[model samples]
Target: MLGVAGVVVAGAAAIGHLGGSDSASPTVAPASAAPVDENGVPILSLPEPDPVEEPQDTAGKCRADRGDQKSGAGVIAAFNFAYYNQRNGEAARALATPTSTVQPGPELQRFIDAVPLGTNHCQKITALSDGVYLVDLSVMRPGQPVDRGTQTVTTAHLDGRWYVDAFT
Candidate 1:
């Protein structure tokens, strides 16, 4: 269940072959290209494929501070929906864990008033230990369309600081 080929040897021997097992069905090249020259051959201006570089996370510092699960889950995912959208129990008791039971009071203020607290941008990070982390909340609408549902937070160590012990 796999076939692939691209061995276009024109003057050494082989000629053409292409796919052979990968459920081949891809070739679609042709929109305006045909002309040869310059000690080479076929050339109509086909050169534009090299611009994909998005893989951050370079780990830069660590001398000894003891608390920064990405700055403590970016301060409890930036105040979880602004205190559950104004139900403001002093803004969810200032970022959860007053014996946290999140949605045990008023359906957590009607589930943070039915979706509408999006805009996370998700810079992606996932260190599960050594202080724990998993921030990815995907949902930035600066240009519209990104309202996924990928929230997560689980930091703890109350008293010395680390907050957010569960965001779901």
Candidate 2:
């Protein structure tokens, strides 16, 4: 009886091995043959990446001459020209007062790094007070729209020179 049972088990195993088309087996399609939706669009398809813009070389683009430091607007113009157009932190800092927010440190370096490559132009300057003014500035970059903004610049007349006391 045991020999008969062993023969039956062996015969069942042989039958399963011969039948290779098992319904329980999982199927994987190649990448090129990805599954499609009802609309015939590939389900695994990804959108094309956006084109990356290269950084513009802004060195030597700014004028070597500084703005007239005698007026509050002039000092502000000089500061903006140095910081944004020239990317010169030291030149910008030179126009700032001793206790001004524009100081030499990581913060200054961060400002230099964050300056966009463009031409910084002083559009208009309106005197708010004796040594304070509202400056309308615009930045122009190649193949881009002009960016316009306003900032308040406070100047101090110390040691017979106008220096940027605060900028906001």
Candidate topping TM-score: 2
Q: What are the per-residue Cα lDDT tens digits for candidate 2 across 91-154?
A: 7888898899777845675777875665455446678899988776676755668787878888
Clashes of 2: 0
Instruction: Please give each candidate's TM-score.
Output: 0.23, 0.55
Q: How much is the lDDT of residue 98 in candidate 2?
A: 86
Residue 7 Cα positional deviation in candidate 2, in Å, after optimal superposition: 99
Candidate 1 regions exceeding 4 Å error are 1-79, 82-93, 96-127, 140-143, 147-154, 159-168
Would you list the clashing residue pairs of candidate 1?
Answer: 2-21, 2-22, 3-21, 3-22
> Alpha carbon lDDT of residue 86, candidate 1?
45
Worst 10 residues of 2 by lDDT: 56-65
Best by lDDT: 2
